[model samples]
Target chain A: MLEEVVSGGGSLIIIDDINCCGRSLLKCFLAAAAHKGDSIHILNFDIPKDELRAGMDSEVAERLVFHDGFMDPLNWNGEAVLPASPFTLKELRVCIGADASPVTLVLDSLSWILLHNPVSAVCHTFQHFQRQAKSTGLNVRQIIGLLHGDLHKPAVVDSVCCLASTVVTVTQAPSSEAQGTAVVLQRRKSRKIVRATEYFTILEHFALKSLGQHQPLMKLAGEKEETPAAETDPAANLTFNLRLSEEERRAKERVLLPYHLSAEVKSSLLQSHAGVAKIYYEPDAADDVDEEDPDDDLDV
Target chain B: MFAAGGSMASSSFRRKVGGGLAVIPGTRASVHNGQLLVSTGASSLDSVIGGGLAVGTLLLIEEDKYNMYSNLLLKYFIAEGVVSGHDLFVASAEEDPSSILQELPAPLLDDFHKNNLDKEEKTTGDLQKSMKIAWRYQNLPKLEVTPAARSRFGHHYDLSKAMSSEMLQAVRCHTFFLPTECGSAICCSMGHAYTLLLQSIHRVIQQEGFDGSCPQKKHKNILRIVLQSLGSVLWGDDICCSDHPQYIHSLTRFLHALRGLLRMSLSACVISLPAHLIQNKAILSRVRNLSDTVVGLESFIGSARETNALYKDYHGLFHVYQCPRLNSLLCDVSGTKDLAFKLQRKQFTIEIVIHVELQGVLRNCLHLPPDLSDRASRSSKQDLSECSKVLNAGCAAMTAGRTHLDF
Candidate 1:
């Protein structure tokens, strides 16, 4: 199952790169929560809000609170672009005013936040939400952030992973656009860690259906092994010859050697001779045959 | 006859687009994801890169050893921009941008179809008239070319002829040439040509109304940006000079900012990086990661494959390292990985290698190790290079379910 493991307290990080899509998984989480009737506060940076609303149910779309960080992000147009800038989160509390329906905080893309600010500042932003959640009348049930894995340094990604309760890395499945693999790592209260890599398909409406452990990556090698063995001609695609030609076979038949016994020669020799055969035995020096014993010297 | 074909193409172009939004003259929406696409001046190349190049995206071309074919591709791109009436931005360090724009290959009259369209129509009519038994075949509706393909989104170019001066001056042009006249040193990152290039492009996008947030002009059009030999020694970049160049990060950082500019503007970029000369494979992969679509050209001029009988018909190998996955779960990849390019006198065609039916390709060509010196970079590029080797071994077992459409 592509389980929705929303931690009871902390956030979940969805890591993706240019090769795969993490937004689909993020939307799946949002859709699941909205069905349960919880408020979703999304900091929209990557894509427009209409795109997010496209595949979602009408009732679910109503629960989304969009903070416009995409249009006039740098305040370039000089018109009023509400909900504050991406680099600052001081207005986040004012934007989430009077809503206490157990909010699920979603950063549409944390990379955009990181590009303008330092790593330490971003870590502090996560900490500020966790420590100050209850006092501000905002019941932050879950915090989910989507990070582009390749854009940042490995150390930066690892440092962010340390702070999150769950981290999900996504990669595109081989030879498929609709299929992908999700490697999920979750840390529990008892310091126990759980990890799993599951293949999944984005069905119609992007309902993520898990394909379980059946991976196309492993299936490719297995198919390659079976085809060569089933071919009737064993030497079809080999680098060297496995069978000899007719001339080579005939040449092998003509060659003769000392003490090389053929089946035909053995049968002819046995039929030609009909004399009585005598039994003889040879003794080794190590056998300790006594010269005085007459029975020992006789051959029968 | 060509005029008749051109009229048919333009009329069809007008029919489908009546949404009240001004349709750009030479662009169309991608069927897969609805992203706007502009052609790269080569029909065969447009097919290979999963339809034409999308707007507000970067297309990276890894230059061959001699930088021959990559230069031609840049010309094709710029020529397409001029033909389509889009604004042009050409930046190069090796040659003057004006000269690069001046020598673009001539487009074949107005029609893109091979030979004469009228002659082909006459032959088809003759065949239908001669075959009296199959009278019903003439009444069947045609399905050879789709209505979308007939829109002339792309065109054929005669490579042997240069575009006329009248065509070159038909559109707006922006040029950037590195200033080395005063014996100003072209050091690694000090001259700051990349910074200057980025600044000028940013200025043009904002001033010329290419940027989405700030559209200054009533007529909205695309700006085709071409950066030739970007990371080579010519571009005052040092990523190619040593294993650890002083400004190794400069190129990648520039690409990141350039892409950011692209995302908000009606602009598309084509950069030809001399990847083979770059000492660090890590740097090359980073450059590839930053770009949206990456395709490499491997010329066979000095390679052993040039003398081989099996590859005699082709000039070089074409490797598509990456395709952009924009606003979708997966990128649209060309299924067949083994592709070759032939530079005919009149045209250039990047086709699925025709020798796929010849079974065992020249054993020597298959066994030769690729020219890549990659180490410590498991970026999966070497895996792409190894795909053809595995194919020529008579077991295309890896690419099992891929569609190989014979054109």
Candidate 2:
């Protein structure tokens, strides 16, 4: 669906958390857009400027616009400076209207706004932004909202969902041990696409890399073979005790191959050469092989 | 008589009265020969240790962000030995040997392959002929080597003879690359690949009877066990040691076992410990006691005075904090703080600053709903009550608190 939107010159609004999934989606979108020379305008609300800068290329840094301010939105204290916007809806309107079109507006996070601002006000502000973006044909407008179990209240989530065209829940998968975050999209009101999960990690500098790029997106084959009891319900309270045996299996496989070979080598050496003598590889052949394989012809 | 939950019968109390040193199980002798060689690849690290890693000693290399450096050093050591005709056995715990082999510098890999081909050329005519026949049998299409054909040719292609033929071929080559298949039912069930590798090396050394009786035999039996990201193994309760009560005991025992079995006059065992473990005094003491010659890599030392102080305090525990370049990589507070107040007195242009900022837009949107606070704290009863009262007082008090927002 995201691919279709981008290809069709439409924008997408992704909502997720900060740790893995949301960061990965944003990274993929940024990488794809940058590679295609499509303009990207990121308006991160949660991540600090330095952190974001550290993660992105200097060229991409040039494309990013950061809005930092003083005063807590919830308390309205003008003294304490916040990392993100402290603007009112009216002020936000002015900022959005002045910005260029065919833009990809990434809120970077909505959870911050919800936590700091009144839910009703945030919803209204989002609706207002949506109307403005629709009027401008901005192509894509993404408002990434991080939702931890402790912070995302149902009522607040519902209000935010109502304002979004599509809702994606980016989360850490149940069994993945790669420090990779996964995303699960739920259209909520729209037609459902296949429930897909993609794994990603936040690389140094807040830049995200998708682990699913080279590997399969999900362990569907393993999941299918396992009994239904193994299929965990995401909404259920997660227990850390749930060990992924497959991960252990993979680790074990990595350790054994060398031992088996060493044994074979040792036994052979003992039998072939006098059992008591040390086996040594004749040295002259290496020099001959070097003479034969030129720099250009080397397989490596 | 220690009774359950009895204060007087506590294990700690018993140790204090006896004044007996804690028996750390897996703690291995740090120096096998007199020298200790800690390999960090960087010159600064080598210098700090007063030289290269001790020959026939076990050196633990900590894991850093760029694991490539450690991997490179492992390959360098192995390649140096292989090319020099020194039989070397490398048992990698964390990564696949195939993958590691693939990542080895191409020229080095070519050298190894060329060396193998060289040895294959030196076999006697009959043995070479038999090897060719074995190779053909091993690589023949599965259908061609059917049970009926095997039975018919059983006299000519004896299974044991064929197997031994391949083994002989591998042994003739000094540089044998064994990619560990750790998870196979037989090995993994017994222990993790690292432990198994250690055990195998121990067995070989024992079989060879290299009890330091012959220095040449001892040097030739040197095996480099690379347990990458040992932090992963140490964190999980994968280490097993019988006599010692503590985790450190098991770790030290494992190391000692390797030291004795490998006949390592000088062997380097690289183990990466989690940042958290560095804080534990017991753990530090254990690691300190385990190695007679210690060299810390990537340590943060604030000033010469502080560093001197640490040396003065833990003089017997460590030899040197070496690798001042390590200070540059110390990003965490423990690294910084330990160096600043505990180790060094010189303030090398220390510029510490804190930046606090708020996030998201502020709006007085349709004042908080009457039930807003109540709804928010519905998850807990006590919170629900507090929220109800707050909600009833509608916008009674609004204070700024750190709240992480996710959208």
Candidate 3:
């Protein structure tokens, strides 16, 4: 789902679970980002550099420059930098690559950075990153930032989401402990958020495979049969709890009076009004025949 | 029986009876030529917004939960433009509008071809007669002797298949992909998005050799301006949050200016806004008031009770909360404004239904038992007499006061 957008050159922010699946997802993403021939830079804050390096094969590791963010005062893997508190955007830029030849920088964990720095600072850093990534000269291809949702405030997560062009949240399955979790991808297209959900399992060699083919859980034949039955009986699933008597229903129908019965009285009244007014000394023929007529000359 | 006339005759009779009460003239819907009624792709949507969308009007669609459905409607608007050969101006502050256009689904040609085959079976002489009548129908109002057959513009699209590039090529789409970066800060500011939008449209109008000064050209080709999503994070201002104090002012100003721009040109605008993201009902209501028409799409698929009650097979509830009354010339065409939409593979259907109110109305109208009815009747009579007595007492008091004043 993300291949088209990520490859096309944009920034993406992935908010994942605290479980190991998130780390596995990052590894898989790095491998994919590297295969695209982008100059890869990994800022590893949660896991040790050695652990991440040992986990991946030399082919993948050789393609990535891992920045150690866990260490106090943050070592840049032997790179020189005038250290600023909580890592300034200028210093981060030097680490990403001074001469950007289609660079893809992966911030493996953002919650660690947020723990030390304010959300506004992190937001500004990302703002600067997007500016660089989108520029024509820098040719900074993609910036993939990973964050753990369990460790950060939702406000922080949302602030980061606002800065990136695409946001992916890897939600763990409630019941399935062994099976992979749901990978919900939301991309900002034409100022609209287009969402697509898929399930992913991390495989050996730091590769990710989608769990199932994109097909409905139920067969098409069953759906066609079920729809007609439901359509014919809209109340098939509804249960009526309010009880009403037959006389009550009749009275109700009478009060809510059908238009046909009411229209007759209106039509006659309108036609009579439209004609000349007349003083009727006797009853009209339209009057009920069963009723007795009263005398007209009563003085009382 | 005096009820000799069926619905047709009864309707005419009623019209005569109510003629004195008729404050507004009867405006019968005509064909594509004279009136500026552009179809919004979906026939139900057309019905919802009166006969069809009026030129020089703005339609604001408030999106439901995820916004994908509203986006589909936007696509339908563009597809309608493409099929009708209207020039499209799509402005976005995020992704490329052209790429989004590429993602529009193709129309279902199977039904179209079948209808064409049926049309071909009609004799050429009959076709010529109909054609001659169609030309006359546009110029004149419906004569009492004959019924006027309404001609509809635009096609019903099938979103199951990929949109063919051939059809896309025929549409003239102008896209303004506003960058979110600060280097183009002046241009891409969400606060200035509406200004930039107006400028782009102004440029288009000027470039097309259309007179922007006259501001009253009623008969010209239609221009479609689509703003994909407003008030989203991607279209953020210098400050990122969408709820900045200036955001509302900027948006309302944009809509007002856009409406003014539309008035002079032969153009209609469709905008999709994420109400969920804005999360402010006051601002949302203001936005609704700013546009000519407002439609809301609410999905109840996630709720079990709501699903089981009536909307099990339906996609969502399509609400026509407001329809523009332009000089009272256009009558509300949709017999039932509120509808339930069901999107199938081939075509989507919007049906009218009243599910939740049946029980409520039934309770109100139910009759009492015999004993209860007797009691109710006696009480009502007593209540009426008591109310009249009170009124007489009040009248007497007023008369006494008048007499004292006279003295």
Candidate 4:
């Protein structure tokens, strides 16, 4: 599902919080997009381009056109540093070009742009770029973004999520190469929302392998608790006696409720025939009964 | 716990780079992976950080309180640069770069052997002192000790003596004293001290031909950058002044830019940061994340751990917080975590605690139960020193040219 949403992309917002990084997960999408043969234009502000391309394949890496917002983002180093494009929509489309069908614009991070530009403006630019490209004869299909969720206000993250067609939240999961658990939420063409979560490992070639759906932790705990405590008694830890001593359990049988029928009565009651039922009544001391019929005097 | 995490398959590996390795001064190719590596001045630290700091990477030193040992480490780095004939770029906010340069510990130019190491002692006394230190490792197989102790890349510096003026004069040194570079007035704009510092480092890398992008006709030499106590009030950065400074990510951004510049250059840097003083750990974590390698020093000064019996032999503890994963999926983690560093008269060394070492040795000898060995490892440093003394006695007896049985 993560792969499907990644490849069938419109605008993807990867929300990563503290303790789990989202870059590797973003790489999984980049790899997926590249596998689909979409030219990826990255607006990199977070990390350097080489560090960006560190684990990626040379062939796929070649397909990534980088506009550097990191190296000299503020023109802080001026022309002495490498020529870099500032974060802008015009530069983005100009790089994507009019002829390239299905070009994917990847924001190495939208949070960096959010910090610089107004929250509304950044989201508006991304949303407008999608619609503006269609009318301009541009085949731009996806605008995938990496957002560090913890860095921004909840309102900012909410706004970013509101605009994105797909939001994949990457969090730490150790079973996989510590890659993380991805909870992908997508809005489909039918106007229905779809959400699925799976523990995923981004395998060597940036291949995504789902470790199946995430089992609710409470259910797993419940399963542990539900297993018979016969092997290791749950009563073992109590300071007070809560166990059945064989002798005491037998003694417990001797002491019964007042309403509990005697063994003979219980046996006789159970033995009654199915069709022609027999009343095997055993009277208690409190019972009152009249043997002679009052109607006998009236009959005479 | 490398988590290699259990060895990646051959098919998973990308094609290896094609070339002969370039020989850089004070550097060697890592045996684990074939990336170029340079020393951070402490060889044991280099080993703990998986061979050495790969060139074009940043090594951040989280300074201990009072900034004594981290400062020494920075000096050790400069001294090694001087010895190796590599160029130096030293930056400090609190002190003059030249004054800091003068105080660098002198390098002990002798061979790895203990010969001529104890110059003041008589030959007989030297023999006994050497025997005592040598016998400490006698229980372990000699093979496990020698090769690691004898790495040839970096030099050891004697903390007692300062480098001669003549030696300091010979090396090319660049200075970035913040007080002189940026006046006493703190910048109201974006971190000007930080910007100036970055700009200076950038200028040095570019003009000095450390930048790989611009090929230089001149011969290449590694520039060893020593940044002292950044984020302190003197650096005109306020990350330390208030809990929520106006610019929370100022120092981190500088480090990030520095790292970005480092990746494309032929230089490696060692920065000493007063991380203990940072009020917010999240900001500190961001700083740690920005740097490629981070090692923290916890000096046993006023801390309660100083009075603890377990750490008697060592002066302080050393932590390998993070090591860069170079060219491999997994990081090169050290075999053991119970590591401590000792600053002896001769040099500084980081090693596994003596108790842990004895646990392995005692397990081999007596085949002790797990609990017994645990108790033995927890025994005070005095007991282990006594054990080493007995081994020294045995070694002394064997040295007397008499028939003796060796373990």
Give the true-contact fraction for every prediction, in order.
0.00, 0.00, 0.03, 0.00
RMSD of each: 33.5, 33.4, 18.2, 36.0
Give the worst 10-residue stretch by lDDT in candidate 3 chain A: A217-226
lDDT of 1 by residue, A1-300 (tens): 356463234688999999887998888888777767789989888898898778887878899988877776777686535533443334556666678588888998998887776454465456446435566667888888999989886656765665578888898876564378887777664323455668777665546677775443333334442232243765688998888899999998788756655656554654536676867789775453455653442222
In candidate 3, which residue ranges exceed 4 Å CA deviation? A1-13, A16-21, A28-39, A43-54, A67-105, A110-144, A150-300, B1-35, B105-152, B161-171, B180-190, B206-219, B238-248, B300-309, B328-338, B354-407
Cα DockQ of the candidate 1 complex: 0.01
Residue-by-residue lDDT tens digits, candidate 4, B51-159:
8888888999998754556777888888888887788999986667998898888877654344563453355564643343243332343232222322347877787
Best by TM-score: 3
Q: lDDT of each model, Cα atoms only?
A: 0.73, 0.39, 0.62, 0.72
What is the TM-score (0 to 1) of candidate 1? Answer: 0.48
Flag regions of model 2 displaced more than 4 Å.
Answer: A1-300, B1-45, B66-68, B105-181, B184-195, B208-221, B233-249, B262-281, B292-407
Measured against the true two-chain complex, the DockQ scores of the candidates, in the order shown, are 0.01, 0.01, 0.05, 0.00
lDDT of 3 by residue, B287-332 (tens): 8898888988876533332324345677777888778767566645
Clashing residue pairs in candidate 3 are: none
Report the Cα lDDT for candidate 3: 0.62
Using DockQ as the measure, which candidate wins? 3
Q: Under CAPRI classification, how is model 3 graded? A: incorrect
Question: Could you give candidate 1's per-residue lDDT for residues B146-180 as a string of tens digits?
Answer: 23332458766888888999988778999887643
